[model samples]
Target: MVVSSGPLNPKTASYEFNGISGVLGITFGLPLLCVVLNQMIRPDFYIVGLFTNLDIAELWNHIKPLKWYLTNKELWTYYLTWFGVLALFDVLLPGNTIDGVELRDGTKLPYKINGIALTSTLLATLTVRWQLTKGEMPELQYLYENQTDLCIITVIFAFVMAFFLYAASFIPLAHKNGKETRERILSVSGNTGNPVYDWFIGRELNPRLGPLDLKLFCELRPGLLLWFLINVACLHHHYLATGEVNNAILFVTLAQGFYVFDGVLNEEGCLTMMDITTDGFGYMLAFGDLALVPFTYSLQARYLSVSPITLSRPYLAFLSSTMALGYYIFHSANKQKSDFRQGKLPHLKSIDTKRGTKLLCDGWWGISQHMNYFGDWLISLSWCLATGFQTPLTYYYSLYFAALLVHRQQRDEHLCKIKYGDDWHRYESEVPYKIVPYVY
Candidate 1:
């Protein structure tokens, strides 16, 4: 496996977003985003200026009665349980550590593949619990009630992990030579001179605990599996609140569950993804995977749980088709890209770039530069739509997703252009558009 490395002095050099934007986003922006979401998802009518059109005076009246406390019990039990179980399951479940992309120093990081089992086991457990307690189940309602605690718990965990990783990166690995020590333990991009950025971006590429790859394990399991579990809880909560499960709620649950399932099944595909290959494990990924994904990824479901709504069979059919089309494009595009990398796609091999890497310019790759991103955006839109647009919070998923994809695509193209140089320009000339076919 080619240990893919970035340019020697490439233009798309930043990942920490370390400057003003990076620091603010990590230190302030992320936590604030979750806080606002948690405030908006209250079961009793909550005044959310982000969502509702109520005035400050009206909002003040609503919030004045509420007592504010920061201590979190559910997050500790729930998040820790999930994270601990993930670590345990990674061992109990049968999957070998597959070698990841080759590092620039020629080291192949090994990753364990047990996501499918993890997801399936969680679903089975939820099912059996639900069956055991037809009406006595309390965890679902408790989760919905104490989401704020969950949010805080993850934030604390993410920051603590970030500090520990940053400090640990400085620990000297015993080696024959100083150069070998750096290569084996530290990362190239994240080894920037700045301490603040290094901490945020992560100095070590892959820190492990015993046989466990903490970076890979945290990113894939825990929060992600919890996301599915949360959806299950939301489904239960919705049913408990309302006598029947709304078709819209069911659709969102199934879509999200499928999304998680697909990721687990196609996790090998994830190795080739920019996140796994390019990103460093730090507060960004830590918060995102451990907190953002599990808590906020199910924003639509949370909203629906609070405010139940149902769409017609016809509308449901249309929405299903839209999501399916997006998933089809998403699944197929990734498969094509993966197959091309494996030399299964005959044409892509001939279209070699100057970097000795081949560029795909056919099939879905021929259409949009980031077809998978487009598909993700479309599916995200569908998930938001499942909540029926009563509040702005319902649309938050698709809105944030759009901004995220656009920024990520731009970042990717900038880095790719620097790496591929003129070949990327030529490919851009052929592709022309970024995401949409005819529109920018």
Candidate 2:
């Protein structure tokens, strides 16, 4: 039988996990992070902070005829540029703890920091970039007839601002990571033996089947709110305004949304479970909260009927095939990994290598070392392709996803190098490709 700390409920046998620490966490922690970030960066604009309804002049400030045309090209350019920069950072820096060192146990040792200036600089630049690119011409119908509902527009604005504000809350976590790293290096565990919390609530006790191990609420909650906003405030309005239904648009929107939902709810099984499990709650969540979810939502070009190619039934078939192929690869790769981890089937022989390091040289890992990430890229590419090739912006999400996965793969490789050393090199020698087979 397992013994547990903390208080037990009067009626139930389970421990009452709720504590002042958690309540105090969201209460002071949220505001404190915001306040410190505000002081550090002092961003002129809060992406999601609400102001009184924007008058024409205020709206006009964001409107640029030249900018609209450039928007198509500039968005992708910025994305690619950032991708390249991040890739370079990953490769050159190769170490990502911001300040921590890896322990013998492979867990991150965190530091306590009042502030991290590097994050402030990055946030300042990122906020400026986002503001500059927020330009878009109001829809033609809205401009001419004034038919668009102010309520809808207002809601969209509110959502955008709120999303940014919530996202901004994560900025301090970077500092937290830096500080935690310092602490871990300097202090002994006997002094502070607090086990790091998972990214999502209730992550410590959950059972996991695979990488889809992240908590549902932590991952899905934001998306669910966004979906509600989209369906009621955007999609429904668009449908009521336009009689025609675009099945392809509907399918992709729902599919992508569900994919996000699935990821959030399944807290125990993420691509970076190995890393998340090793880090504290703030660190585990900061990346996903600040980047993945926001970017995923931003890719919805449905608001602008934008496509690279014509959104016809014929093109959709190609899109469907792409989606299906990607799905198969991702699912199969995950299945293969799951099977291997479970110590079963043909992979059993691979696991039975003379030298334990030799195990990575065989099975799915043998194919490309990171066959799963290859499948991930395929899935991302297929999703982007489904949007059709009209505006370059449609492809930005996929491109960014590719770069991110590659960046992550490189980081993982570096960590593996430190963790496994020659074993990792030996494994890499056996399986040459990092992501895509024989291509990358």
Top TM-score model: 1
Point out where model 2 deviates above 4 Å.
Answer: 1-217, 223-233, 264-267, 290-292, 303-310, 346-358
Using lDDT as the measure, which candidate wins?
A: 1
Q: Write candidate 2's Cα lDDT for 30-76 as tens digits.
A: 43332222222111322123233223233333323544433445343
Give candidate 1 misplaced runs (Cα > 4 Å).
1-18, 46-52, 55-75, 174-182, 185-188, 348-350
What is each predicted model's overall lDDT from 0 to 1? Answer: 0.74, 0.41
lDDT of 1 at 151: 71
- For every model in order, what is the number of clashing pairs? 2, 30
Model 2 residue 178 CA deviation (Å) reads 29
Cα error of candidate 1 at position 284, Å: 1.0
User: Model 1 — TM-score against the truth?
Assistant: 0.89
